[model samples]
Target: MKVIVFDTKPYDRKYLDKENERYGFEIKYIEGKLTPDTAKLAAGYDVVCAFVNDDIGAATIDVLVDVGVRAIAMRCAGYNNVDIRHAFGKIHVVRVPKYSPFAVAEHAIALLMTLNRRIHRAYLRTRDGNFNLNGLLGFDMHGKIVGVVGTGQIGRCFIDICRGFGMQVLAYDPYPNPNAGIEYVSIDELLSRSDVVSLHCPLTAETHHLIDAKRLSLMKPNAVIVNTSRGALIDSAALIEALKDGAIGGAALDVYEEEAQYFFEDHSNDVIKDDQLTRLLSFNNVLVTSHQAFFTHEALEKIAEVTFENIANLSAFRGNRETYLANEVCYQCEKFGGDCPKKNHKNCF
Candidate 1:
């Protein structure tokens, strides 16, 4: 099968090329993100492999369909960028549902620890020969409350880590998991009680801007928030306001709402035009890492393996109407509790 990969980076090519040896599918790599303008590059290809930041909206889907692309293989778990409703009858969409949850969960802990202890500031200070320790005060994690926003694989792993630190965990999920072994409280209660708030939820319409001005007000003034999940999950503008008003202690982020134009690429030589982003960078209390919570070796290997497997499965079931793609995401089915009305159909399209 012919496949074109968008948003191709050096690490992505290295791992995907290694995994592709098993399937031996013809693949092309492009450094640019898959947008409506770049969709034409997939002409004559059977599938398009995309990453998190690619634009898979109606316009891009239409372009892919016109170019004879039958399917989209998302290497990451989140599909919020894809217009699933519009692509339902136009193209098939599959994704890597999970890949090394520890990679992301561990990163969240790393962020929290670094922010709490002021490790980043310390490192910078010692490097420049100014080893004064006046503002490096930090508290103990033991016996502190940590609010986990989601109870999925990554969130569960984070909860385990927090437990190891002797921290109390309070969870909040619309659909709580009975096996999670933590008390599921309302979001407001969790925010107000937790000394640390870590976000691990997916980006959905209901979850978009889950942490806003009102919700931020519920948090303790000394509370710190860590986000390794989707960027839009926390309202950026509200967060800025809260920071200015000293409503929250600090923020550690691996993602940003307007990161598509900046993240993954080096812009050190250029001026940052986004006012919000620039303001965010100016805060010493805030720590920002480009969306790289899932950049571990194990995660990359699993992502490559699962993505190719999804593509191969789609290729094998092209003409068969009885076979169902397990990783295939249908908006209708997802919205209605996994009971797809078109169960007998091979693909939503």
Candidate 2:
């Protein structure tokens, strides 16, 4: 099988090449993303494996389908970037639904600790021999109420880390898990009671900008916010306003709401157009990373391995047994229990 992997980061090539021989596919690593403009890159390929930043919408999918591309494999767990409904009958789309949840969850904890202890600022000060800790006082995480907005695998792992710190966990999810040490609460209650709020939910119509101005105002004056999930979950303008008004204490964002223009690129020479992000950077309380919550060594290895398998399995398919087929995600089996109960052939999952 000929596979073209777009959005070829250095780390992606490193891990993908580590187990390249096992899949035995003629792989081409492309530097650019899978946008409508770059869809022609996969002209002769059978499968295309993409990352989070790729534009795999209707137009891009049309190009891939017009060419020989059969399967679209997302290396990341989230499929929010792909237009599932539009691509279903035309082309196949597969995703790594669960990878190393600990990688992302632990990264969230790292951001919180870094923000709380002022370690980022302290490092800058020590390099210049300032050695000042005047305004760096931080409270312990023990007994602090942490509001976890989702109870998925990543969210559960995050709760595990917070519980280790002896923090009281409050969770709000459409599907609650009692096994995890999280007590399900209303979003309003969670916002009012928590010292830290972390968003782990996926981006949907109902969840998009879930943390807007009204919700932001419901939070405590000194509460910290952490988002390692989809960038669209929180309104960037609302967050900026909250930060400016001191309605919230601080924020650690792994993903930005408008990341497509800037992320995974080198723009150090140019001025960033997003003035809000620029202002956020000016403040010591805000910490931002380029959506690197899932960049752990172990997670990358698994992503590579699973992506290779997805390509191979997709190539080896005879007919309808294709795991990467758009119908498979909507094909609810007995194993799916009551979770995927949509038998209306809508592909709405």
Return the top candidate by lDDT.
1
TM-score of every model versus the real structure: 0.98, 0.93
Estimate, for each residue in 58-170, the C-alpha lDDT of model 1 and write its tens digit.
99999999999999999999999999989987789999999999999999999999989999999999999999998888889999999999999999999999999999999
Best by TM-score: 1
Model 1: CA > 4 A from native:
344-348
Model 2 RMSD in Å is 3.0
lDDT of each model, Cα atoms only? Answer: 0.94, 0.85
Prediction 1 global C-alpha lDDT: 0.94
Global lDDT for candidate 2? Answer: 0.85
